[model samples]
Target: MKYFLAFLIFSQTLLASDDWGQNGHRTVGETAENYLKSRVSKKIDRILNGQSIADASTYADEIKSDRAYDEYKPWHYANIPFDQTYAEAEKNPKGDIVFGIEECISKLKSNKLNKEQEQFYLKMLIHLVGDMHQPLHFGLKEDKGANDFKVKWFYNPTNLHSVWDTKMIESYNMSYTELSASLPELSKSEVQSIKSGTLLDWVEESRALTQEVYNSAEADENLSYRYMYDWFNVAQLQMKKAGIRLAVILNDIYS
Candidate 1:
């Protein structure tokens, strides 16, 4: 088995995406579900099945779990330069998105990978595809969304980024099955378009949205019930988007 690493931050109440300070992760899970259905296509099914199945059938489950905490990984923040350089940096080995994905792909390709390693790649890919859909994971510019800034999350004290990464996802109170069933379906064209962009473009898209989401909220704001209810709309949008984008990426990879 591969040595699986867990990075979840636990507390009294689970963090729901609706309570998140950022909405970049809104669409991940839903996007992935959409992608999986399309995999029934003979060409992609063969590719997915062709993978070294010396491992087993934990592939989809592993992918979902990997994406569970993807929003909070503290990567990509250290990547992406401030301006024109951001584009150039992606071409370099050290780029945050580049290095992370490369590491994942390398692990997938390594013959030494035990079943555990193969599984890790599957999960990590699922999570990373969602992360890549989140613009903040593309770059944080300065604060990394208040990882450095401390604030009270309603009654609880936490950082801005943590609120978005964990709290929001936990708040929905829906089991993954409930959440999955409630989400809207992605159209074929929608699937194609969301997955069409390069990873760099995904980052750039998120980076652009980040400015608006972050700037709209103030530091030290008290996020209570009312605030969460209002933002739930945003969270739903993000979740749906994630599902669509995830399907796009997975369908392409397995294709």
Candidate 2:
């Protein structure tokens, strides 16, 4: 029974390492929903069949178990090395997060897609925007976005990716709604600044934070209160950025 419990916990951690985990993704989704232009919001509602962005946020991750979605595995992240800009970084043939996002936006903007195709790409756009904001999602290919950078989270063995993806957010024990509500309020100008960057620009921003994350959390280090205390604010800011940027994308595509 004890072993089973341990296995369950380990399994949960592994699941959380994918994408931004449910809470982080949904927090971004919910926050974006609040900022959406009314016409864009209505169009998104029609596409998602009245489903809230928060609820639709995890659809990409949920499809991972099916073999059909194997091609999308790489869509969750872009592995650009620390020294290279995204433009200079070699593109992933299988499609990285950056490619996935651009493709989604391009397809979404085109009038060629049928309603079903439009809905599919729109969902992908929503999820990929959230993924793009996760620092490690723009990390080194060699390390698989720090998945191999094993560390201890309050004494339990885990990897750096999981720490940033879920552990820090989970440690706070808040629902997505609660987390969204607690995000630092930004002025219109501040939000515009965050939303102003291009897709590659945002990728570069996350890559910068990825470097900071790697420097802060060394392999085998035991990270707990201090680590979370220091980085949670950064995570919150990223979430807010993601939300605002998602709204920016949706508004642009629908406008």
All candidates' lDDT scores?
A: 0.51, 0.87
Point out the worst 10-residue segment of candidate 1 by lDDT.
Answer: 52-61
Alpha-carbon runs more than 4 Å astray in model 2: 1-16
Clashing pairs in 2: none
List where candidate 1 sits over 4 angstroms from the true fold: 1-31, 37-85, 89-95, 102-116, 139-142, 184-189
Report the lDDT tens digits of candidate 1 across residue range 143-194: 6545655556766877666655666556766645455566655677875676
Give per-residue CA lDDT, model 2, range 175-211, as digits (tens).
9999999999889889888978678888888888889
User: Residue 45 of candidate 1: its Cα lDDT?
Assistant: 36
lDDT of 2 at 209: 87
* TM-score of model 1 vs. true structure: 0.63
Residue 69 alpha-carbon offset, candidate 1, angstroms: 16
